[model samples]
Target: MLPYWRLSGFYFCYFALLGGVAPFLSLYFHHLGFSAARIGELVAIPMLMRCFAPVLWGWLGDRSGQRLLIVRLGALLTALTFTGILWRQDYLWLALIMALHSFFWHAVLPQFETITFGHLGEQSARYSRIRLWGSVGFIVTVVVLGLLLDRFSPAIYPQAMLSIMLAIFCCSLLVPPAPVAATRSALPGDGFLRQLWRPGVLVFFFSAGLMQLSHGPYYTFLTLHLEALGYDRVLIGAMWALGVVAEIILFMVMSVILARFSLKQLLIGSFILAALRWLLLGFWADSLVLLALAQVMHAATFGCFHVVAVHFVQRSFAERYQGQGQALYATLSGCGGALGALYSGYSWNALGAGWTFALASVAATLAALLLLRWMPGRAS
Candidate 1:
């Protein structure tokens, strides 16, 4: 029997931690009197670690066939290192804590992705069903913490996040080991780098990176932006939840959508929707109807885009190179995200919120045009 619940449980706790951090971490820093730029810089630390750590960790998993050990160790270290945040809330101390904790935290997901795919084997279409639990976790945490933070202080955020990290460690314990992946079509001596160097795969990774670059403003500042506009904390959290809610709905029907739309088609649509969503948020943020509508676009921007990318990576590489392929995906996405966070950090104060999001819109548009030029529309 498949260890469905075990895998789902891990994704739940893991994403619940992410859900808490994304909306509240910057707010927590702001509460400590950090400027928007400082908060952005501090937030980018983990993302930067993500850019470099995965290659080493992914290689170890591929060679050793011990991905679960890495996942468990990563979870434990993430929690232990994160406890340093409570020691000092100063900018330097928080930066250290973010880097230490996130180096391990970021390493956990890519290895686990390889493990989860190995477990599924032939039932790959069911991937979305298990992954949707992650979306559910995101909604639950954001909504509950949205309510909690409204009643308390952002100072309480760290302890709450630590608890989720502990839960991730616990969930990691429940997931059993899966065998290393095996593929029928893998060539006898084709190397990982050779497969990754393909022109089509290069365009796909670059285009995906651009989409994540577009996300920098939204991830870093959307909560702060909403709060400044006088929206209550509960409403702000719900707004975040609203996007994931749409994503959950999409994940449920993703197989059907994929059957109808090519990955290239989905990628282009997602990029276009992302551009429009950022523009809506940037120009009309005060308009609740428009804000809510833009939030709903997360289904395409993240949900459909993510499903397509994961599938693309799984298909493009040979079985032995699967871990490295997933790692490369994370690396490119991380590089884009780190750059996005840095630019938004500097721009949030100097360029203003509207302009920062407009920049995001421009990045998404660039991604769409790039993909159109190179990524063939062949159904994948």
Candidate 2:
């Protein structure tokens, strides 16, 4: 058996923390009275660390064949490091803390992704089903916390986040190490580097990075933007939840969707939808109905795009290097996200929301063009 619950439980708690951060972290930083640029820098710290942390941990996991141990240690360290937020409120103090905790926290997901796919074995298409639990966690946490923050205060954010981190540590203990069964391709260690150098593979990574880069404004500022537009925190939370609800619905039928479509097709569709989605947010955000419709495009922008990306990484590398493959994906995406957050912060203040999102739309449009031209049309 696949220990489905164990895998799902870990994702749930892991993304519950994400749910807390994505919508509320900026609000928390705002409450701390930091400038927009400072908040941007603070948010970018973790992503900047992700540019290097995952590969280091992935190398260790692959070499030792001890993925579960690395996961536990990473989780525990992440929780411990985050508690430093309560220790001091200075920018330098939080900066150091963000970099430290993110180094470990970023290490967890890529390895866990490798392990989950290992568990799924021949049923790799089922990945979306397991991943949906994370979306579920995001929805529940965003909604509940949205309500709470509205009723109580944003100061409670840290305490709620701490509890979720502990839950993640506990879940890490429940998932046993994945069996090292034979992979579809048995490439030698040197072959992975060679495969990574392929032109098609390089283009795919670049496109994926662009996709995440386009999300910089959305992830970092959507909540604040909505609030500024006169939406209540509760409605903002519901809007966030609505996107995940769309993501969940997509995951439930992803196996069917992928069965009938190529990864190239899905990636192209995702990028195009992302372009339109950002444009909607930029030009029509004042309309609640239009905003809600735009949120539904999360099904393609994130949910489908990610499903295709994971499978692409799996196909491009041999089983022995799966950890490294996933790590590289996360690392590249992180770099893009860091740049996006930094630039968006500066732009959000200098250019305003309208122009910032227009910039994001351009990024997504460029990614779509890359996918259309470079991604192989054949199923892998």
Q: How close is candidate 1 to the true structure, as a TM-score?
A: 0.91
Off by over 4 Å in 1: 31-37, 88-90, 152-155, 180-185, 224-234, 348-352
What tens digits encode model 2's per-residue C-alpha lDDT throughout 1-380? 88899999999999999988876787898999999779877877887898999999888877777878888999999999999998888999989988998899988998899889888889899999999999999888987888898899988888888899999999999998887673455545557688787656888889888988999999878987888888997688678778889999999999999999888888888999999999899878889999999999999999999989999888887777788889989999998898788788789889999899999999999988887887677536
Clash tally for model 2: 0
Clashing pairs in 2: none
Give candidate 1's whole-model lDDT: 0.87
lDDT of 1 at 13: 91
Colliding residue pairs in candidate 1: none
RMSD of each: 2.4, 2.0
Give the lDDT of residue 100 in candidate 1.
Answer: 93
Candidate 1, poorest ten consecutive residues by summed lDDT? 177-186
> Model 2: runs farther than 4 Å from truth?
150-152, 182-185, 227-232
- Give the number of the best model, judged by lDDT: 2
